[model samples]
Structure formats: C-alpha cells, structure tokens
Target: MEVKKKLLDLVRDKIRFKHYSYSTERTYIHWIKHYILFHHKKHPIEMGKIEIELYLTKLATNDRVAPTTQNQAFSALLFLYKEVLGLDISEWNIQALRAQERKHIPVVLTKEEVREVLQNIPSEYSLLVHLMYGCGLRMSEALNLRVKDIDFGFDKIYVWDSKSLKDRTIPLPQKLKAKLLEQVESVKLLHKQDLKDGYGNVFIPYALEKKYPRSKLEAKWQYLFPMKSISTDPRTKEKRRHHVMAQTLGRNIKVASQKANLNKRVTSHIFRHSYATHLLQAGIDLRSIQELLGHKSVETTMIYTHVVSEMNKAKVISPLDF
Candidate 1:
C-alpha cells in the first residue's frame, strides 16, 4: 500500500512540476491507480509492454470504452513507464486492439434557437453565456478569464495559453459592452470586500507566483467571473476566490435547454459550434474564424463549412418534390 501511494505521489509531483492543471492531475492519477489495481496491485515496474497491451485491449473489447477514453488510459500508463519508472517502452512495439473512433458532426443551434436558449438561461450566467457565443470561447476559457484579459479601451479580449497553446484576440461584442463594464464594477466591489477580509489572493501558476509574489493579491489578476464565496484551494489549502465550476455552468445550460424546449441537445461547446457556423454564414473567411477560435489547424475549423452546407441543403429540390 505504501509503495502504491508513493508511486502516485511521485506522479503528482511530476505533473505539478510540469505545471499541468489540477483537473489533469486528478484524471492521470485516476487512470494510473486503475491500471495498478487491474494488475492485482502489481508494481508498474514489474509489468512491461505485454501487460499494458492486455489491459488496453480489455478496455476496448470488454469494457467498451470510447476510443478517446482508451487513448487517455494508454497515455497515463505510458507516462508512468517512461517518466516515473524510468523505463523506455517505446521499442516494446506492443500492438493492442484499438477502440474505434466515431465520426460526429457537431450539433449547432440556429440564431433564433440560440436567442431562445440564451433567454432561458439564468440571469447570473447570461453575460458569460453570451460571451461564449459572442466571442467563440470554450467554457474553460470563458470561466478562466481574468480582469486584465479584457481590453475595454481596445475593444478586444485577449485569450492566453489556451488549449491550442496559442494566444488570440477576439473582437468585443458591442451589445454586451455595457453589461461587461457593469460586471467589472461588481467584481471590483467583491474584490474590495475580499481584501478587507484579508483574503484577496487568487490562484496563479507557481512560477509566476514566485516571479511576482504580489500579483495574486491584485484585483486585475482576479477571475472575471468569480465564485460567490471564497473556497480553500485543493492544492495550497489557501482560502481563495476561484472561478465558477464548469459543472455548475453545464448544469444550468442543461436546465435552460429544457426550458427552451429545444429538440436538439445543447452543451457549452454547442455555442462555440454555433459561433463558428454563424460566422461562416455571415461570409467570414475560414482562416479568420480559425484564428478567432484558436484552432491549431485550419482542418479542424473546416468542419463548420460542412455544417453550413448541410443546413443550406434545404434549398435543393429533391426528386420527390419535382
């Protein structure tokens, strides 16, 4: 038991050392633990490529996990062997039966549908939701926004170090400018109260925190959409105001979809898809949209073209209609 715990502790240390997010740390730990238990608590060092292949194959053939899920498990194990165990499994040439990936066309809402859904969303999340749709932000990017990232003077929003590992700028929505300013004022008030309570610190990356020790205490570094109350940081055990949880936003979106009585499913990413598709419909160039969405490849952004084509298929008359 001690050995297993120590191994996981080392993995945690490495992940933190690499500056991975807490969510990623939790997920990698989960897969690693599951891998060890599946082999009856055998130390990972004792197993080699064969054992790894067997486990992954079982996930596909028996457990029926999705391709991405299986790939994630594989990545965790690979990290364990190569990084933690100091073993080079690259030449092992383990061939496991891979799970099949399904092709999916993303669900998108029409402009009217988007309006109906946004109207049904709770007032508290209205601005955030609008920002997501307006600026084509992922839920994480929207929630992680800090006060300094918004450029009111320039009328742009700066997204830094996003999933694509690229920084991009988005044009601020004209309609939401007043609401956003009001939000910043509210955040300022909340920050003042937090400072008065001697708990104004927000989470900063370890390296940055060390470089600028007082940045965490600054109002501009605070989350744009902070939680209602301060909570203890899972890692540092410090009382800090973190942004709202993704789960809370997701739950509220689900409820709003129900209220709107939309026939199609609605998720946070749907807004992003709608954003891209709507842009394409407005004759925005694909390359420009790709930059706004922060896609690593233009190919990923091209999916919206197909979506627009499918939607426009109504204009074609079928033989039956003739």
Candidate 2:
C-alpha cells in the first residue's frame, strides 16, 4: 500500500534535497504553514499571486511585522510556488509590504567591554565568545566547529557551509591557541568515554553520512564543543554526541551582560559585528574584511565602516567647535 505525503511533507523533502540550512527549512515551513492556514488550508497550488499579496499586506498593515521578517516570508512563498509547485510567479505582480530601511548602526563592544563580558561568563563557555569575536564566526559556525576544522599549525579556522553555502578560512587568534587545545583534549576525553559506553558517533551532514557511513565515529568529525550528554539524533534516531546549543550560549551572554553592567543590547552576533568593526578601525581594507567575514559583497563589509570609532571621529563635528 502506497501512502501519499502531505503538501508540507513534500515541501520538507524539497528543502532537504536543496541542502538548505535547518534554520531556513524551519522558517520556510513555518511561513508556508501560516500561508496555508491563513487561506483556509487551500493547497498552495490553488493559490496564486493575489493570495500571497493579501497575506503579505495583512502582515504589514495589520500584523506590523518588520521589513526583514516580511521579506523572509516573501522568500519562502517564492520558493514554494517556483521551486516546489513549479508555478511561474515571476509574471504575477507582487506588491510586497515595503519595510522601512534600517538606519541604526550595529551595537559593538569595546575591547574593555568585551573583556569584562568574557570575565563574567562561566569559564566553560567563555572560549565560545572568544571564537565569535576573534575568528569572526557566527554562533552556529563557532558551535558547529569540528576537531579537524581548527588548524593550529597553520593558525586557521576552516568555516564550512556558512551562510550562502560558502566556506571560508579565518585566522586563528594566537592567544586562543592554548585554550582551544585544552578544549580539544576535553572533547577527546569525552569521546573516549562515550566510545567506552558503546556510543561514540557524531552527526554528520546528510549527504556525507550517506557517502561515508563510518565517518560519524571518526575523531576528526567530533564537535569541538560537544554537549555534556549524549542525545538521540532527530534524523537518524541513534544516540550521538551533539554540539552545544546556541540558546545556552545566548542565555549565558545575557547573564554576563547584566553582571558586567553593560548598557548595550548584547548577543552572540554582536561579537561578530564587533570583530568586523574593530578590524575596520585597525585599518584593514574592506575587501580583506569581506573575505574574512564570508560576505559575498564588499558592500556588506562596508557597513562596519559606518560603525567603527574611526568613522565617528572623522565624520562628527562637535557643536562646541562651532
């Protein structure tokens, strides 16, 4: 007996086939499910351009979602109709909700402030914050790091399948070398204990798992920041050691911020932003920063220039002088 899959299930299959990130898959599925429910569960194949516009307009005019959130929903729908349903929505007029341009600069911590925040965080997770700032890694990138990704001899951190499906290498901070090595020893000890307990596998990327069935147990494949306990793999249903949760790191940062008496809205990403801004302030060229940050465009890297203290010094004229 052949059982048919639901529309959302088919959408999930398509997203997986395309190798989209898990976060993107979740976001797309959420918006698609919302769109379906908003339209009385009408199959997306039956809904066209007009339905999308109405939903987006409601989000802007009634729900008042921010521009970026609205844009994300729009992208999800676009993928659904074009990629999943094979419908041509390009010809249909899409009156998307216009979001106001973001004018505020990103919040960045000074060197002293970063030091204070790190001091306040628990020692177990402080290294993660250092990696975020030092290597310009996003929270996911830092947490997803494997044993082989950190090349201590070469002083490089290999970032894999980052945003935009791009892989990049960042300079490993010399100051962090000893601490990272210690951390690696800890992971090795944990892995050895797990293997002794008859569970030593780590989750590999979907395609890689299929290609190299034995790679999951390889020492180099273990997460650098493995979680404290083993868990069942959601996809494979086998108990494996997963990396530390981003939320745990985020919560620690919030606590550290309060303890440090910082006045800014701080998050894990703030470290990455501060990294770029600090590099720009140090006179690094925009092109080089772009490559280090894995930004596809130099323009994206240029945003840090606006927030660097050097720019403020050059651009702001004091009223007292006038």
Candidate 3:
C-alpha cells in the first residue's frame, strides 16, 4: 500500500499539471512498482544509485528486454528520481541496452491491393480505414475525431491535441462529406443515450472542460466515431463518453483481411503507409504530404519515397545492369 499510495499521488499530481496522458501515468507507475520490488520492497526514498543501477542491469541482462523498452524504463526512473522524488541521481549510469536498428520501410499495399482490401471491409470499418488512407491520420486520431472538427465549409478537418498536443487542420475530402453527415447522425443518438444516463460529459484536455462544461453533451462536440458504450473517466472515475477503441477496429480489420485472403500482414498502419506512397506516386509534392501526415520533420515523409513505385518513371533500365 505504501508504494502504491506514493506513486498514485505523484502520478495524480503529474496529471493535474496536464503534462502527460493516462497511458504515461500507468507506464510510470508500473516501472516504479518493478523498481521497488527489485529492492525487496525497500522504499525508493531510502534507496540510492547502486540499487537503481542493479535494477537497470537486470533489465538489460537477465530480462533481455528490447532496447525501446529499456529506454522507457530508464526514462521512467529518471523522472522518478529527479522530478518526483527530488533526488540528484544524475551521476548514476548503467550499461546502455543495445537496440536493434528499426527497419525504415513501412509495409505498403499496392494500389490495386488497397482497393481489394477496401472492397472487402464492412461499412463502419471501411470508413475508418478510408479516413486513415485519405487524410493520412493515425488510427487513434481518426477514431478520436470530434464532430466539430470537420469543416465542410472550408474543406478542412481539425486535429486537436494530437501526438505532439498541437492543433492542425488539413483539407476534408469532398468524396467523404456525405459519409461524415451520416456518421454525425449516429453520434447524435449516442449523445442522447449518454444524456439519459446522466453521463454526457466527454473527456477534454485541461481548461476546455471548464470553458464548455456542457460541450460534451452537445451534438457538435460529440466524437465522429463514438464508442459503442460510455466509459469511466480515469482521472475523476466518472462515466463519460469516449471514442471507439482502435483494438475493436483492429479486430474488425483482422476478420476482414482474413476474408479478403490478404497474405501480407495487414494492419491499420498499412493504410497510412499506402496513403503516403499513393500520394507520392500521383506526383503530389513532399511538403504537401508532410502537412497531411502531421509529421514534425520532413525526414518522416522521406521514408515513403523509398517505396519501389516512387522511382523515376523516365529512367531507362537495362537488364544488363544487374
């Protein structure tokens, strides 16, 4: 209970500042728990650099954890000692965990294969995939889209508090406008149900809830892809509306991919990768693609250029060159 209470309070304060997500809070709590257990239940306050180093060493050697995971654990511990506990543990060092080089090429479906996959999905899942492919949205961003975010008048969709917690808008598809209208109607029904249950308030970041307390109940502010059921807020522990889980969408996709007889390991990301590659192949400028994808750097967009179909069409290839 001591370890749990200490961490829960620290994480709650961290969340109160609006500095991280519920997922980050959960991950930090987990690492702290593991760190404590590594010391035979000794409090980290009484612990020192040597104990932390031994734990990190175990994660690298005995656990053989992946490099990314090792880095995460390192970061969580760093935050705990310096930020949470106010301890100067900066002098402490551990052997860096070796990381496998991440492969650069994202899996991309061929142009025709994309159509085949699209043809096979059910209506709801198909729409989700379409937005991901058409707008270059992350699956979560597509699922989390609010009704007000769509701007048919301006032909743009606003993405708020995304990966970097930055707001950006990109053009809306004229093709999908009718589908958005139908989707909004469904969201209205879900909004009514939440109102009936006295749980109309949907989660919003920091001051937005105070600015518009009833906004969650309003049709305009409802999620474009509302979850099938209401959810309890992690911070307040009150039932509120949330968007459909990406896992639900993923399962639906998995079933459809099997039905479609797709041999390539299919995922929601495949659609996003196809979006970039297809746009590049169609001769859209890289800077334009960068904006659509919400990438901070042009470097991320450059990966799609590596796909075979992006090669110069005018180049003459000789069979003898190989």
Candidate 4:
C-alpha cells in the first residue's frame, strides 16, 4: 500500500510545480496552517465554504486583521480547496468580513532627504538604495541583479522577472557608473576565491538551470550582490551563495533614516516612491514614468500624480504675487 502525502506537503508540491515565488509559497502555507489550527485542527478536506467564511470572519473581527490580510487568508484557503483538495467553490457565497479600501498616498522622500539618508548609510547599502531610487527598482529586483544584467554600453540595467514577472530596462545612473564597474571587479575577485574554495555555485531559475547546466558556475551568472555567507538551498539542499537578504537592506535603511534625523517613515520602497515623484516633478510624463517603474497599468501609476499635486499645492502662488 502507498502512503498518502500530508495536506500541506501536497500544497507545497502544487505551489512549486506552478513556479510560484518562495515568498508566496511561504505566505500561502502560513495562512493555510493558521486556518487549520483556527478550526481546532479540522481537516481542510472536511471543511467547505461555511467553514472558510467563519474562519475569515474571525480574522476580521476577533483577530482584528486588516482587510487585505483577511483577503490574503481567503485566497490561501481558496487555493487549498480548489487546487489541493480538488473542490469546487465557484458557486459558494463567502460572507466574510471585508476590509475597507485605503487611499493613503505612498511616502516619498525629497531629493535632499534621499541624499541625506544615502549619506548616512554604509557605502555598500547606499549603492543598493541609490539603485532603488535612481532606477525605481523594487528591493528584490535590485538584490536579484546578476552581473550580466548590467549593460555599460547600453547604459541600462536589465531588470528581469520583476514584481509582475515581467522584464524592463532602466537607464543606469551616470554618477554610479564608475562605482558599479568597481563593484563588478570586486565580484569577480570574490567569485574567483569562492571557486578556489570549491563553493561558487549560484541559484539559477529552474528553466534556465535546465537549459544551461553549467551556467551557474559562470561569472556572468553570478549575483551582483551575493550574500556574505553561503546557505543551503531550501529545495535542493545544495550550499550556494544567494543574493543579499532583503531584510538586511531594510534594516540598514532604517538605521540610516534614524541617523539622518528623518521624521517621516522610511523603508526601502520609499526610494521607489521618491523616484516616481521626482520624475513627475521634473516634467516627465506619466506614461514614461510608468514604463520606467514597470507598472502594468497607468492607473496604478497615477498615485504619484497625487503626491506631486500635493507638493504643488504647498507652493501655491496667490494673486498678491502680481
């Protein structure tokens, strides 16, 4: 007789088979576990729409979860039922508590503020922050950059498999060109040393790893910002150097912000917001900014317009100026 797999293991298998990001898999698994435990360890197979609705309602009311949090939980459970358990929830009416839509503008730093924050951070992390603000890159996109992605001749950085799993190129900052080249040399030396120690493997995407078996050992395939220490790959268990962790960058930015005396909340993403807003202030059009930011919809990019509008209002000129 064959042994059946655990439900969460089955979920993990399906998630990986679909090529979902590890973060997404972790988040989905977390919510699924919470859902199961919330119902006193009841099997999800025995639960249906009503059980899901009750769980979601508890998240909203008793747990005081935000609407988006509740929705994420719902999505996780939905995936569990439809994909893992092979259940049809199409016609089920889920009367769960809904979170109110928020309209708060994103926090953006002024040019001077951005510079101040950069000045306070270490040189290495400052470069990362610079890329985020200068190129409007997400933290992950910046960290995941490979040596081959930087094109000096074209004067652009190729951002592959970004937030929406789409690719785009942004102009490299002219000021950072020399620094980037220097960093490349440093990476080459590090890679050489790593290879000398017989531990130079880097993680490649699944499809590419299959297509180019030896690419992982190539210099061009090496991470631009490799982690200081090697780690075990969660899936393969092979020891390799991954990209710098996003949390490290986040913490560095937080420390820099505090040191810079910034009263506003600062995070890695604030650089991206500042990038978009500064471009709009410089008379760049929304469509172009949208493309630079790799936003799927111009509508999603319109939020920066609000930020700029608020800035403009602060500088209002009265008729007394005449």
Highest lDDT scorer: 1
Each prediction's whole-model lDDT (CA) = 0.94, 0.87, 0.79, 0.88
lDDT of 4 by residue, 201-284 (tens): 898888999999999999888999888888998888998889889999999999999999999999998999999999999999
Q: Which regions in candidate 3 have their CA more than 4 angstroms from the true location?
A: 1-4, 88-95, 309-322
lDDT string for model 2 (1-322, tens) is 0111377777888998987777888899899888888997777877787899999988888888888899999999988888888987878978766666566678898889989998998988989888898988999999999999999889999999887578999999999999999998888888988999999998888899999999988888999998888888654589988998888999999999999999999999999998888888798889999999999888788778778755578678789888
Q: Select the stronger candidate by TM-score from 1 and 2.
A: 1
For model 1, how big is the CA root-mean-square deviation? 1.0
Ranking by TM-score: 1, 4, 2, 3
Give the worst 10-residue stretch by lDDT in candidate 2: 1-10
| Per-residue lDDT of 186 in model 1 | 93
Clashes of 1: 0
Tell me, by TM-score, which candidate is best.
1
- lDDT at 231, model 2: 88
lDDT of 1 by residue, 220-256 (tens): 9999999998999998899989999999999999999
Clashing pairs in 2: none
User: lDDT, candidate 3, residue 181?
Assistant: 77
RMSD of each: 1.0, 2.7, 3.1, 2.6
TM-score of 2: 0.92
| lDDT, model 3 | 0.79
